[model samples]
Target chain A: MKRLTRSAQRALDRYLHTLRTCLTGSNAIDAHEVEHDVLGHIEQELSECREPIAWARLQIVLDRLGSPLMWVPEHDLPSWKQLLLRLRIGPEDWRLAYASFALWMLAVVALLAAYEPIALGALLGSFVTARAARAFGGELDQSDRSKRWLTEPALATAALVLGGAVLLSVLPAMALVSRELVEIDTLRLQFPSVYHISQRLVAVFERPVSWGWIRSALLHGGPWLLLPLGAWWLVLGGIARWRPRWFAITFSPGRPNCAARVGRLLMIAGALVIGTGVAIGLVKTLSIAI
Target chain B: MKPRKDLRPEKWTTQLRKGVLELCVLNVIATGRLYGYEIAKRLSALSEPTVREGTVYPILSRLKQEGLLEATIEASSEGPPRKYFALTAHGRRRLRHMNAAWDLLDDNLKTLRRRTAP
Candidate 1:
């Protein structure tokens, strides 16, 4: 290519960028060849022009090039290519929005028809599409009033799926960090008060800790489960408040403050449960022999 | 900012020009190998607004992709290497068939229009 002045270069770069974008979205085969052809043609046209070609000179050549969007005739395109081209170029980048909604709808239909695998597939697709949509979407797209119908179902599903996994993970994490409190003699010799608290803790749970126990407790731990569940919520809530940004994936990016508030609520609930357990354990341990 | 596609009367003609341009490009290369710029120039001279000069590249690329055309890049004294496009054996066969079909279609259309001429 001939040397182009800054303005000429910018214009050419912008044109090529738009062409690249359209081609990428359309899934056009051998797209680089088309790009190379355009560049070669531009170089040829400017070859005769004086050195340091200006935008004024380059603009004329580009004007004759027409739009890259309509370059491939509709009939020439593969069916999928045509669909993607239409969606990508559609108004307001509605591809992500509508595609998510469509997938979610398909999932619902599949579920209705008792096709669990298909339903799960569609739900997974919806979540993926929604995540991708939100990841790429601009602030305006995020705040659009109509986005609820288009994006919320998948986003909500994603939140529920992810939030449940996080909650379930907390119990095992706590178990890993806390072995059987029955082995309190290790702390008994070092910290007398800590051993006292450990004894009270074991009395409160009335059971040993292990993977099987945790699994059973998860299903039927009853009121005893409240302490662990509260702790789980408390930790999550703290993280949500401290770094609301992290919860952006689990909730709408714009609503991190809501996550913070939810965290605060979780912390308060956690405190109440822990306080109740401590009070109950202290009473029970105090009544027993030393 | 776009070049005017066509006036109302030339709308159909502009649409027809897209398909015709493919055959025209094959015919141009059938003569001998020509670089991208020269082919665009020759086609542009024949049809200005009706057939965009810019469209020739995509048609050339499509034909090349479908094995109808092959390109070789050759260094030029002018500057950057020039991509010289030539019809392949398959391309020559496709062009022959296209030309034959066009002749048949063109003769029938001309005869029908003549019979119905107001």
Candidate 2:
């Protein structure tokens, strides 16, 4: 690149800065891509310049480029509406980010609308679009204030969904694979699948499994569920510990470094839960067997 | 200011240029793959009134996003790699339609101007 006079460089910087500022929030454009193109254009235009290109010479090029403000002429909307319009229009990733937010908002509306199917569909859509936005943004952990506001709810829900499923199902999963103790089916909920899974869990260790095993496992399994559920809490704590900013963005908002302390406490609690669960499982097995 | 309600001829002309600039860009790329600067320069020379130099970059970005145009980067000795844009098959079709429309509009405007001339 040809060296530029100090004034020329400053002029170029201001121009590019203004261009980026104008472009950054446009929904129809990727600001960075345009910035790169602008730079390339300048490089080509200045290729044959003197050893140190002067501001006057550079000004001519910038003049031809026109004022950056002209590219994004202000709209005629009312002040409040114009503010909303500003948020609505932004760089390309922001479109997906806003779409995800809109879907998330719709999911909330569906919740109030008392519609389960629609709520689930919108939640799923929000989750997908949020992930797409994150992927498109090219940052796995991007948490720009604008972007996170648009995406965090969906991402948080995703964490909750996956974490909830795994945590809830782990005990039954463990029961299937682990030794049986005092199997007594209590706390009857009318879930037919629960009944079937319960019966199968009971006889699972004895013979070819039947739904009877579920009944037996249910008796001793209630306390044991804590083990895996607690471990999941610890897993999030670990994330909070390592990437506290990401933890704050995705999970909860708190002061800096709080994730570490919070995560440590969760791990300790999880360890205690695991210990208690194992001891209870072992003691119950012995007491019931004897 | 209410832009659509504004009756300034300059403002109208600017809007008109923005609309046609896309057509002009595709036409430029239709000829051959050209780098960003080169494309902007070619269109900007249409006297910078029809197309501002900086504006071409945004248009290129949009066209590429829309899949009408695609970009390739090649190494350069002076600065960063040059981003060369070319028309996709879809772009070619769109350009052909735009060109036909422009021609029809031009002929009608000419006829109208002739009829109204004192």
Candidate 3:
């Protein structure tokens, strides 16, 4: 057989990878025998060609064989495998399913670790996964176009709320467990400034504070910020649903409406608030250091 | 008399070709053993809608699994070792039955066509 160029070899590898994916989890045919036969066929074709093998030429041969997914005779597949194919969100949504499952697993791990940052991120990840799944499912379920808009957003919102609730409930237990395992003195020594800040804040409030209390306060307080944002999103969604014309006019290019103007003003106000807060916090820290 | 028309001739021919492809593969290997590439080449050369090399392998694999075909790996001078396939005794018996069925079907269809011809 004529030697394959570097690019041609890569193309062949990709073609084989697709074939492997199609063959995996399939019980109707012996994957090994089919794979070997395919390789042999490619080699024979290359040998017959007078020119050196290139990606364009190899692509022509691969395309003639058709898509690997099409090669599997669905009727020959076992009942379980047939069911799996039918249940799949879309023709290529297996990747999304795997991603969603992985994110859920990570959320569990983050909850166990009592890491609020990672846990929150994981909750958002689940929302994204749910949204992606719904989008793909909608594309596949084209017959139900009217229901797609409602169902997908509802599913995504449910995933977000449920995942967040589970994470929140587990967090307090995780903090309590961590507090009992670790010594307060060691924690103060390890994070002196953080301990000092908690102490000062507790003193101002005239209340007792510990590492666990500080962590709980911070973690719980973080999600309160999301409430307003979520409400805003819902408001926008409601407006879009009830008055699409107004929503479109508000967002229309070059000609902004009252809502758009108000939104822009609010955004600017938010940025100013955050900027001022950060600047104040920076100045205070610097003054204390001096 | 008026001749009957196949409204979807292309679709009908496609289904017919797919149904007979396995039988054609059996007939190709009836004379002697041939590798997947060689079998595909012979079929494409002789038939319309050229049999692709990729399409031929799965059929070979299915046949081998069904006990109708057996294969052995032989080292080649050109590149990798090639798998050569041959029909088994059971395969030959099955082929004989398939051929008889094909002949019967073909004869009956022809007779029907003759009666309907203009």
Candidate 4:
């Protein structure tokens, strides 16, 4: 029932823009209902506040709604569908990313359990080599926002590789220490139950410090990787902003001559293959040695 | 207590809005579907000349979603194609029911005012 203030009208308009960005559809009816509900809630709260306090209360309400920029409209569910189409993220391709992740995890577990030192070393070498190649190659040349190293193919490969490496190294050490601890404990069973020093060492191996090393590697190497990635993003952003046509031609799906798409697939495949080879080698070594 | 100068205008506007918006919207949609801009223009012509175009869309969307009205897009010879809305059979029944209720209420209020007149 309250008449919207000029500022409230402006806020609603801004919220609508982000909702449209998140969702595209012929019917904005659902989104509009949400906006009305939000605005009405603010109005109701403002009415309850003292005259002087109303303005600040209204601002607080808006702040709680978050950056009106981030409101995803319930109606605009088509945006994800559109993006998936534009990115050529077919069901098969999406399934492949999931499958690849699962395979990498399985390989890491197998290598750690088998404990073949030489093969494990080769796996690490191959993984490092693939990552280095992808890094040195123009593959990492994507923009910072676009590439997002934490989730990107290269980083995932690096993580998988590192996880395998640590597991391979420490699992054997853990087994040896555990064996020594048990032996020591049994020998001193009759005497004052003496604790084995190797038990402490084994405890150290079991700690998640192995992944800590991986995290450290990422933190150290991230910026160097991100710099080129950021530059790539800036360049891509510039292209998208100013010359969207050119950008689309180079990057959009189904373009026969689009070097960017072909380049991306080739680079990602190369990295994954190299990473997998490294993992397999590590597993083989771990299997033979231990 | 005397009201502040600024508060008086806002209070009156809110009162006017509370009284009229649903009736205004129903009247506008009585004939046929018109996109938000047209509805705002028609509402503005009835009273305040500066009706905010932004306010109408939410009401229209709400009404459509409420199943009182159905909306669809048709090609326009003008700019972009506009979303046209029409009252459903349910909406017509509801509107007719409300209109009758309002008439009875209005009649009772008038009768009460007359009997109490000084």
Candidate 5:
């Protein structure tokens, strides 16, 4: 016989006492039956344990077996299926949050592109910076307190500051670029090659017939574009609250499966190249008639 | 199984719990060489409050892997013959070294705390 330690013996004694209570109780007939079933289950587990049972060790085993809930008729405890479902929680929720973020970004791009292509580009640069902050914020782990920025307001503040700085930097540069592009378009109108190329490209889309129309396009489209982005931000924030690490994994690029991702990128690039080539060829044919 | 997110984390007080196996195995063998269950029970008594399936076996496997312990089959009545663990000379030396280090660490912590006190 493998001698049990005093502590192990004590734990077992407590367990047996609980078991006895469950089985021998004078109350419910069902409780007594359940006790017999529980004893059989416990015996099966103990037999498989292969080692001598100690008091403390026994308690751990019992806990793992889910504390063997008492057979209460009215309690709202989760069923086995529910418990299993809770444990098998998927990353779908995080993926939905990420899709929301991507949509938000597209909305912002639409806004900026309408306001001023250059300013839109600048806003894009800022958005990229904001994204970096979010990535770092998401990487924070619970086991390591020092890394958690949510609890430390200073870290969050720092990230916000950096993101804002990026946005500010991009905006002015975009405005300057847009102004220069407008000025250059005016000066180049008299040059045959420049004018022809510009006219061909310009004709591909519905031209803004007047400068006023251009200004109106910018003003009207700008805020409307940001709506999706705002929604995305809210969705991402919600996801982060639900399961921070999963949210990070869903949004953060440069994930482990980079090779498969590269294949997708290559396919998209090929399609874009083909489309651009066809567009240029069509413009050339249209210009020849002119 | 994933730990419950809502419950308070369990606090293990003693430093020995950090490397409970080496010490516990040594303590168990101090009487006589015994099998896996015997050693696990002894350790569970002193600390662990509970032991379970697959827990002690890993520690035993680790000790054997490190060459501090060796296992051999012994006749038993409960089931199949049991695999008992005994400390090698190397194991005994390691236990001594671990004990010395633990003592040194404990003493330093105490001294530092005492000095820092107001």
Candidate 6:
């Protein structure tokens, strides 16, 4: 067998890279198996030719093999996998949707574990879900118009409910559980020194406070916390309905306009300011009551 | 007058080709054990709408997974080891049934064409 020329090898590498991209996330065949088979086929063809194969000749052979996208057998996928694939935001970008959903779930778990913030988890979850829903909406646009209102709105509503549950319910429940684990008598007895230190710290920070005010504030303020997020979801859903491109632009920072960039920066700053204010209020209220 | 954009022939041919491609692939392998490129080359040579080598690998992989075909990696003098695919016992039985079905379909189609001839 004769070795390929340097230029030919480089061209083959680039071709294989594009082929690999097209074959990614394919469930029908192992990517490595296909790559190995393709490489073997190419080498077999190359070996039959004279020594020092020309780069153009190699390209011609690759072209004859056709685009790698042609080899992605969608029918080979199981029904459930196909359904999940349809949940994507773009053509051939189902992998992004899957990755984002996986990350969103991980962020949700972290929030429930009390290892992350409610706001952060809510933001991540809503962002990814919105992106995925946007992709689904795009597909819906090209599909039957009769089903558009039903499916797209339903998806947005589900996302909003999930975001609210994650923020209001899961985060608070986990925080309560974490607080109880620390405050429990049996656990406190097991860590007497730690408990004593915590008590001393609490005593130092303690201030006189009425329990009624805190209770009433929580009863009133808890529901209000969801207002900003609910409004955001409504606005997002409205944009997604009327102008999907605008919805896409709002979330996708890769090709953002100058206005979007500035808006995103301002939103981040506002979130930080609000988050800090909430943290301070919570600390002050808890110090007085606990 | 605008030319009629009749697409039924192309569409029907595409569907027909897809339907028979697997059966054709099985028949090709039944002749002898063949590597990926060999199978593709033989099929493209024998059939319409030439089968590219890349298209052959997935079908080969699917057949192998379905227990209709099995592959073995053999060391090659040229480059990487070649995965040679051959029919399993089940595959032979499937090929027999598929061949019988094809013959029946072919006979019926021939009779229909003869009857309809002007």
Q: Pick the candidate with the highest lDDT.
A: 1
lDDT (10s digit) by residue, model 4, range B1-118: 9998647987678556635566668768988877655675577567663334344555666577778888777766644445676888888887888889889998999999999999
| Model 4 lDDT at residue A68 | 29
Give a tens-digit lDDT track for model 5, residues A251-288. Answer: 33323243244334434544444454455455656777
| Candidate structures ordered by TM-score, highest first | 1, 3, 2, 6, 4, 5
lDDT of 2 by residue, B27-107 (tens): 888889998888877887774564578888888888888899988899988677888899989888889999999999999
The candidate scoring highest on DockQ is 3
Task: Residues A1-290, candidate 6: write the lDDT tens digits.
Answer: 35677656765775676566555566656667777788877877787788788766787788677666566555665666456545532244344444445555555666677876753655465455545544443322222234333333333444466534533453244334444555778768898754554443333223233676445433433323333434444444444455545644543322234334434543454455456446655776787798
TM-score, prediction 4: 0.32
List residue ranges in candidate 4 displaced over 4 A.
A1-29, A32-290, B2-13, B49-51
User: Which structure is stronger by DockQ: 1 or 6?
Assistant: 6
What TM-score does each model's chain B reach against the true chain B?
A: 0.89, 0.87, 0.88, 0.82, 0.73, 0.87
DockQ of each: 0.37, 0.40, 0.42, 0.08, 0.02, 0.37
lDDT of candidate 3 at residue A67, scale 0 to 100: 59
- i-RMSD values for every candidate model: 1.8, 1.5, 1.9, 11.0, 14.6, 1.7
Model 1 quality (TM-score): 0.48
Q: Residue B15 in model 2: shift from native, Å?
A: 3.0
What is the per-residue lDDT of model 2 for residues A61-147, given as tens digits with 9 covering 90 to 100?
887877665665454224554475456434443788888989989999999999979988999999888877665543332234568
Better of 1 and 4 by lDDT: 1
**Chain A TM-score values for every predicted structure, listed in order:** 0.53, 0.45, 0.29, 0.21, 0.23, 0.26
Q: Residue A133: error of model 4 in Å? A: 45
Candidate 5 displacement at residue B10 in angstroms: 3.4
CA-lDDT, candidates in order: 0.74, 0.72, 0.62, 0.49, 0.46, 0.61
Lowest-scoring 10 consecutive residues by lDDT in candidate 6 chain A? Answer: A136-145
